[model samples]
Target: MKFKNRRNECVTTSDGREIWASRSVTVVVCIVLVCEDQPYILVNQRGTGVPDCQGLWNLPCGYLDYDETTTEAAMREVWEECGVNSLELLQGADCEFFSAPWDISSTPHDARQNVTIHHGLHAHVDRLPAVSNAHNEPNETADIRWLPLAQADTLEFAFNHRARIAKYLSHLERVAWIRY
Candidate 1:
């Protein structure tokens, strides 16, 4: 099925199952930082009061508000969660879509089906922020830190962030020849 302006579309699986497009799409932005030739990612730990994935580390991310572009939402989330106001989108880092309820069940009895659009971003900063909570939502984020890419796999991450980070790192490696 297709909607006007193509806002939504339906897909049919080989098994003869049809899937409807999600009504909500969230944008997950991975902010990359390089220091002394080593790469790092800005991540936040979900607070205990958070509704989901409490205590798990994840990239600075948030849902796209009504009428807000992905770029705007990414920048806003980074600033609010990490206090980093200067960021640039990585070249060739296009958005990726991931479906929720991996089972691909047509009947979602709980949370509405969601599609997460991931974006990669880069920023140069002299130092990391000492304190977070800039957005004043403690339950959403407990703490923020810069984690070395090599050590990212050591931490428990929320959602599919670990895979997303790996994808971003692969992108960086592929485009290493390009300057800025």
Candidate 2:
């Protein structure tokens, strides 16, 4: 029953067994849009000072705020990192927040030497936003682009983002099959 708190201090129980604290909880948002009859995912290049992923591509993501839900955090990350207000321009008839069908672990290793809980979210939009509309925050996002979902594997992604994209693709395939 003993566990480590946010400060990494152990909360002792009678048994005194230690449980690791989850220091990082993040929501990764995959914003999909149809361009020229193809699906593209919004991605960003990590800016300088971004721990392990600096200069590498990644899905728009950020640590969850204490007052936000995972879904809310996902939308916020998209807007902050990609400058696209997904919730307002949302137009997918099948639009919903879905995770991979497989048992993907929520807990993953962080470069900062902390336990991380990652929540993957997918949202399909009817149109693409102007690339110029996006803004960059210092030391967080360097560049933004709409990468083809099929080509996601071709790029080097920070952390487990590649796997997260694969999970989204899997969900799309499942949905396609379910339509029949």
Candidate 3:
């Protein structure tokens, strides 16, 4: 989170078009890990170099590559973003999820997408920590924190990350909001 926060940070690529609307190209699969020993949630300080939501705080996440299932994408993203190796470490199927149209409105006319990658959130308890979060470059991650749940919202994150995380937590809690 060392990078500058560009309020209204709009991610747009122009092959020379001048329209002004925002769009999400790839589906982002994210996860939250609850540690058993410490009543803390694991979150990574996203390296500012990562494309798009650079310098922002988010769950360990990555884009789904071709032909990957929702579960596959989530697992792959967890591995890529956090350096985790096995999905077996986690054991659960609960999350809070909300999605809007992945937009390319800001892009050129050719930015139409036939395939829509839905944004997914997956969470589980980590029996043990893994190497997925470790990077040789400090820029990738300056530090990892097992932030307290009570104060989790105080920290800053990009996109609708906080909402996504809170929503997932709400789902896991079996709250009444899900019916709406």
Candidate 4:
């Protein structure tokens, strides 16, 4: 059988198992900021009207727009969510792929098979600055704050962000000596 996927790519498969290719792919970016000699991560609290994880904190993230590169999407999300335009990507922050098959909850509400490509970066800032929700979609974000790495571990996070944060924290610990 042959058909066109959501992105309008033609696909041909002999068997029925390949139907999953029709699902949409979303690129998400998260920034882990270390400021004032302490590691911190910027997270946003989901507002009540959000489809999932309302009132829960998670890293600044958003879907990749059409015709946009992952890096472009990452920078755009940071600016829109935190109002920070000056950001430097972490040296080795490559794309990490996560799919709904691994964790169904990561899938978007409308997708049958969703893949999220997450890119984590390090923000350059001396201190945490005030963030505004003015540019955020209605009820998309309730609040934004920079949480200490240790403190963040103790709080409940949306999706697999807790694990993702832990991984970043571990990376920071391993490279601390060199950075000092």
Pairs in clash, predicted candidate 2:
none
Q: Rank candidates, TM-score, best first.
A: 2, 1, 4, 3
TM-score per candidate, in order? 0.68, 0.72, 0.55, 0.66
Order by lDDT, highest first? 2, 1, 4, 3
> Which window of ten consecutive residues has the lowest lDDT sum in model 1?
96-105
Q: lDDT per residue, candidate 4, 48-110, as tens digits?
A: 868998988887676767797766766677667666552434432332212111121244454
For candidate 2, the 10 contiguous residues with the lowest summed lDDT are 98-107
Number of the predicted model whose TM-score against the real structure is largest: 2
Tens-digit lDDT track of model 3 for 8-99: 34445677555543333444543444456444455666776555555667665554466766456655655666666435544452443323
Please identify model 4 stretches exceeding 4 Å from their true place: 1-21, 86-112, 171-180
lDDT by residue for model 2 over 1-180, one digit each (tens)?
A: 986434665666679977665456666776666656677788988888566668889888778798877667776778778887765645442544533212234443444443333433344455677653245566678788888777887888987788877766676557553110
Indicate the residue-level lDDT of 107 in model 3: 26
lDDT of 4 at 168: 55
Instruction: Let me know the TM-score candidate 4 reaches against the reference structure.
Output: 0.66
